[model samples]
Target chain A: MSVSELSLDRDPSSRFVPWIVAALSLMCAIALGTAFALASMTADWGRAASDQVTLRVATGDTDIPALVDQVARLEAVSRIEHLPREQVARMLQPWLGDVAQVDTALLPLPALIDVRLKPGADTSELRALIADRSEITLDSADAWLAPLQDLAGLARLVAWVLAAVAVGAIMLVTVFATRSALVNQRQTVDLLRLIGAADGYIAKRFQRHGLRLALFGGIAGTVPGLIVIFFATAAARLQGAALLNGLTPSLAGWLAIAALPLIVALVATFTARVTVLKLLRASW
Target chain B: MQQQGTDGTGEPLVAMRNVGLRYGTGPEVLRDLDLELAEGSFHFLTGRSGAGKSSLLSLLHLSRRPSRGLMRVFGHDMQDMPAREVPVLRRRIGVVFQDFRLLDHLSAQENVALPLKVANSMDSDRIDEIVQELIEWVGLSQQAQARPPTLSGGEKQRVAIARAVISSPRLLLADEPTGNVDQEMGERLMRLFVKLNSLGTTIVIATHDLSLPGRYGYPLLHLEDGRLSNESGGAA
Candidate 1:
């Protein structure tokens, strides 16, 4: 009989391969999703920081309107806003608590000015303009956000590495499973060979079996990951956390997750074919 | 018209010169064998239980390579043949094992249809039709759908025999093919083999039933302690 009809699907080792593959797929999907989300968030934060700078002017002896007009007049500066004293205190409420509000005269506060720079604007002119004003210090968003951005970039790299490891794990597990299946189905393989079955015909049956299991497992694993991502994204959105907005995967990210099953199936099929052909040859 | 047994090269279907076989550092089971089977030739291989009849059949089936000899089948040197070409060569040879190696998962019909399936020479409908007819001929119509595990010894033997002949292979080797069946069934199975032989299939039956060789009037190649002898008791 054709090796396809040899009841290989009922083999004991075969029963566990799909579940193992599914577990690996789930881990892979989640890792990839995390990487994608981190990338999205990093891009958003980098864009916001790259085009903005903040100026903190000491309260005493500073002409805020004249400074704003001077900064706005710079050719590279797109817009500038001088924050009122009360708003600066409000921004520090999380750190200073109600003390800043208890009495404005109790502490010396700086006047905050937010500045937006045009794309490709050089910061040297702005820095030079503020250099002579000892009380006015220019703080570029990029300078303050560099450490946080580095941490996010490292996290994204780790997630990508984890996803790649998951794929490698799937391949290794498939190899073991295929080898176990061959051991279990030794009698059937010998029978097929005795009956004049070509090695390709026998290997094809195993390849098809491996592909089927991998596809089923991949889809099963991806579905749960998608569910988790959906709910996690929803929760992040509900909480209105600006930094957490990047937790949602983009369209391309979703498409990659969707393609995971096919990728894993191809891997499994090729592995099974090579393993079976090599083992069959060894038997001869 | 029946096709010639040889592949138009006038070579015997099989030629073994000084062939010997052993299992993993053990004493040789078959020793210094030199034999040839001409195109469309029929012979009975008679030997005791340990006379290496199965070993010889396995060698012919390409299941094992001769340890030190020049063995050729269908005009190809088996020792030098590529691994991939083994299956193509095997398709032209059919063997019925002594133990009736029918796959327990497949039904009798599927077992009988195996050769055709592996050869892929016939479509499913034709395979089914032919398998059914062969099952009926072997008196297994009632057990066509029965798995090998559930079938009786004689029934399983019949299924094996049917499988061996289904592909109409150029060389047919049977190791005690009728050992499980009664005299009536054995005679019936012999008729089937004779019919196939008449149609240009080379046949070899290894059996302890010494009466068969004389009754069938075929040449007898007797084995005695890993050696072959051409007996004069049968037709030459």
Candidate 2:
């Protein structure tokens, strides 16, 4: 058909449906990608926290004066805070809630030490340094956070698999839709064949149609997905200091989400083109 | 008849020799038919309902290949031609289906514009002008935007005819073009076909409408069962 006639027949607005699908696919991709990022970040945080806690416990026997001197000697040690028994007890009171029985006896609470490390401080070297200080004992710091971090990693892996499955589902839907359109327009196709239309031309029309639908659908699916992600991120940020660390999406993460709709569109286009070509070859 | 090969000049629009066809090894629908249609020669094909009128037209339109013989169009042998080449040849042949096979999604004008669009040969102005003229010719101008589902039988038939001839093809095949129309509309459609023929478009009308051949004084090839009858006569 003439280009103008083709344009007249095509509804440009019809593209919204595939765009929606692409958008949804994008959202899924973002979710998957965010889960991956969170998993990595949490894992790193858990390891650091655990090592710090271990160092604090190992140094527990060091006299206050000796510990202060040791802390002053280490270049990696940026800042240190020594908490007395009363402060430790106060901190535990929220969970312990009116511990009158423990108050009568001396609470066997270890002195709390907060240490900040310099940027790029090697955790292994620092752990070794604290280990040599026999007067000090450092128990594991964020040992409790390991399970949460591991769970995040597992969730990330599952999200990746779900994204892959979503892509497969999109391809199947495009193929099914193209086939139905071909069936409905069977007579028209036959007529076109009779009049000397090339299979490429016939397939092009369908590909264009399919691509548009997929793009719209992807957009539809992605917008709500992104919205959900946005809300989750915002909620995490709102927790402020209470959160272990605020989750921040990087530029690459956002870009990956944005690129998803285009990917869905491409997949739909190719699937439709291949399906139409196969059907034409078989029938005509 | 001597089977003409490519003579370096423009090829004969259609040539078939000992052409036979059947449905999946069943009895042949068309048996050993030898025919040549020079460019722009108009003829009428008359036969009983099951005598393979549609099958012959299908072959002419490249919808099916002959099972037992050679067929060539515009100098290209169809037997070994790649499947991709079929549509290029189809663009030059216009076919009016017996069933008025208009697309339900498209309006009358869009349906008629389909041929020109398929060929990718016209600009908007030319397409619009030609489509408008044809629609006017078929008296469907008032229903230009109406889709096939809403159109009357006669209206649908006219839309099909308009589509078939819209490309101004080198050959036009109309199978029972007037089958669904009243006598008045049939005559009008025939006049349109005659006008197209006079303009150097080869036309083949496949019909049981004996009155058409008699009225137009065109040569008639009559078929019975799967064979052509030897007797040649004109209606009084």
Candidate 3:
């Protein structure tokens, strides 16, 4: 066996290295996936929310043609469309089943109008003008949109927090594993020192070994995580929830994910090197 | 106060003035020791158990710093040298351990080649050539491919000796080089040290063998109760 492999073969911690790396990768994938999903969902919600308003008018005695004509001529109104009554009834069908049998007049749900706005237009003026009628109400969706946007932003922050924790965990794994290897190979390291092997030589050997273990572990851990994300995305698609569009990484994103193992490996290598140099100095 | 005695001008290989050593919080083991060995000299360090022979050798090997002293090895002042320069200093010396700390994972030839690898002196093929010749010289050519776990005590002892001298270090220190071997093998290993000494390499072998200085006709440095006594060469 090569000199580098000798230390690893004798070390007890070698067996668990891959597992530690894999666990970290799995956790990272989930976090990144959730973060990606949240961002995409927010963007979609924001796009659908902008430049629009939903209106519910009681239409008790007002002429339908007159209301439509007045709304179409409003200064800020770009386009107006009537929300079909059947579609609105279908939405409430789960709670009020079979709208055909339900009393249409007694329920008296106000007629809904879909309003498109000119860019940068103020809706408050129009709302004030319509509110005087006592039969009209304006719903701009900004109320729920602001809260959902905040929720998405919160998810992104959580994802970032998770990523930071993963990095810390990776560093911890390498430090502990390197320490264990050092302890088990005490005789070997001492012999190297006596032979006048420089600290770098000895440290390099262990660093390379730890880096390899972490790389393999990272891959073992990461691949499954990515696979889980892919399956989850597919499941979401099958369930007709496009909100998972965020979870599906783009080409550049996949490349970054592919590099996770290498990042962990590098962390392992650096940690091992520093640990050896310090320990060697301490011994002398 | 550290001072450089300097190198490359026929300076002594080692010079210690009032060198004192003790492990952490322990009583002094070697106290007020003053000694020097001229370049290219051979000596045996003979002392009783717990007489600080190993500790003194440890100081010489650069494995331990004298707790208090002005010490220089290869003319480089111990305290004046930077920590980064320690390994560079150590490369000039060879040490054989009493435990025969050969890596069990490596074969006999690989163990011997280890010093050359560390020194980065020659290419792999050249190292292989030099290590092969030494393995043969040590009379272990037949077991050159054998790992430490499979080798007998004598075989391991020879391998350790070969590894120590592989780099042709200016000074060779053996902490009980023959501690684990039989009489014949012990004598044989001593002969190897003698052979290296004759080639102008400074040699110091730490052993309890009081008869060794007399038989080898080399100078003796005797340590008793942490005190060192220098004796003249030739069976004194």
Candidate 4:
């Protein structure tokens, strides 16, 4: 037999808990999704660059063959692939569209060679060797990769900050909602008190109600966000992995969305529990 | 004035000594009172409109503590008891207010089942059965499903009375329970209290209707100037 003498009809339209939790849930989904995507992209970039270096030789330089020979003999060098001039030009197509009108020999284009290093090999000796050649320039992809990776890391940080703010907002809204509920049910509270109801009993009732509202609202808000992310990822992939393609979360991000309702519900429940306990103590 | 008047047993149900109550900085509403109620005792706590009858009942209901002196219920010092233990102490007593104080949202049956719910009765089926029976006993069976706002004054009073005694509380206190009902309905409600008292429930009713107590031969406890003028003999 529950002591729930209160009718939720106190103000039926005043139930803004679901909308509040839902909006927070949507924001949480976006943050988590973006963070997870950026993190995975950063990991992929690091793995590809960790054991490799690239070298650029001026296109018309006849010393390229000797440079390649010397580079291959280095203890750190495993194998090197010399890029055809056309391939290098194609790589620069986005910035210099259709440069074929210029004569290939007179073009300022450079021939690129990709170097794969043996595990645990020293690239310092190779760098010293390449420094002696005026026509050969050695560059590790990580030079720019590091900053790109850092940008991804920074994005992940921003997502985490967003998540923290969402959780804070959840607590704030739950506190106000719990307060409103307490005021609305003031008569019920007094009646229960006069009838010898334990404080835990009263608190439990409000906590349960608040948790339900948060769960419903949170799930309602999160599902649409997940769908939007999924469709956006699909649309981008259909366009052939265009720039800014990795906007979808990895498996873990989806899992977080799956569990978001419970997490937010717990937040609401715990907040209500604490708020009710404090108010009841003050009444005493 | 620690007059110990136990009924059959050695310990009185309630014992008070020079108890006085003041709200914040206000003047005392009850003061300098020494009293004891034996188990199963019945008293009509009566006075004029502003003579502190309800204030005395506030103490009895554990609504507030005395600013000075001692107040004990069921042999436990109220001031010395932990705040958390107030609910446990309150479960032993029941109160009916002048306004009835029935929850407007809950149905009459729900209102009546409140004390039983507070007592944490395990058998839901039995609780339902008893609540229905009590509603019938109060002659509101037809109105059992009705909300407080929809019921007549007499019907609301009946529900309040049922709620107060549903737990079979050791102490039952009513403040002007019959204030809203007509003469016949008031008499009928008084008989209900009398019947509960006969069933070994200690009853105290604060009312201006003095005839019912004399008719039932229960003592009248009169209040004046925030002090009790104990009238032990019935009908005095």
Q: Give each candidate's interface RMSD in Å.
A: 2.2, 3.3, 2.0, 1.9
Model 4 chain A: weakest 10-residue lDDT segment is A5-14
Off by over 4 Å in 1: A1-4, A57-77, A94-111, A119-136, A236-241, B1-8, B136-139, B229-236
True lDDT of residue A282, candidate 1 = 86
Model 3 over residues A1-284: C-alpha lDDT tens digits? 25552458557787887787789878987777767656666766665667788778885876656676778788988989887777777678899988888876566667888888887786865776687787777888789779768977988899979977987898888888888888888878877777788888888898888888888988988788778867886677677654444446556556677788888889889988998888888867
Give DockQ per model, in order. 0.51, 0.40, 0.52, 0.55
lDDT (Cα) of model 1: 0.84
Best by the TM-score measure: 1
TM-score of chain A of each: 0.86, 0.74, 0.76, 0.80
> Residue-wise lDDT of candidate 4 within B139-194, one digit each (tens)?
99999989999999999999998998888789999998888989899889988988
Candidate 2 CAPRI classification by DockQ: acceptable
Which window of 10 residues has the lowest lDDT sum in candidate 1 chain A? Answer: A1-10
Docking class of 1: medium
Best of the two (1, 4) by TM-score: 1
Residues A94-130, candidate 2: write the lDDT tens digits.
7788665458236666566766666566445456766
lDDT per residue for candidate 3 within B9-48, as digits (tens), equals 7577898889999999999999988777777778888888
Q: What's the CA error at residue A147 for candidate 4, in Å?
A: 3.0
Tell me the TM-score of model 1. Answer: 0.87
lDDT (C-alpha) at residue A123 in model 3: 83
Q: In model 3 chain A, where is the ten-residue run with the lowest total lDDT?
A: A1-10
For each candidate, the alpha-carbon lDDT, in order, equals 0.84, 0.73, 0.80, 0.81
Global fold similarity of model 4 (TM-score) = 0.85
> Residues B158-219, candidate 1, lDDT per residue (tens digit)?
89988987877899999887788899878887898898889989999999999999899887
TM-score of the candidate numbered 3? 0.84
Misplaced by over 4 Å in model 4 are A1-3, A9-13, A56-79, A84-111, A117-137, A232-243, B1-4, B7-9, B210-214, B230-236
Off by over 4 Å in 3: A1-5, A51-138, A241-251, B1-8, B230-236
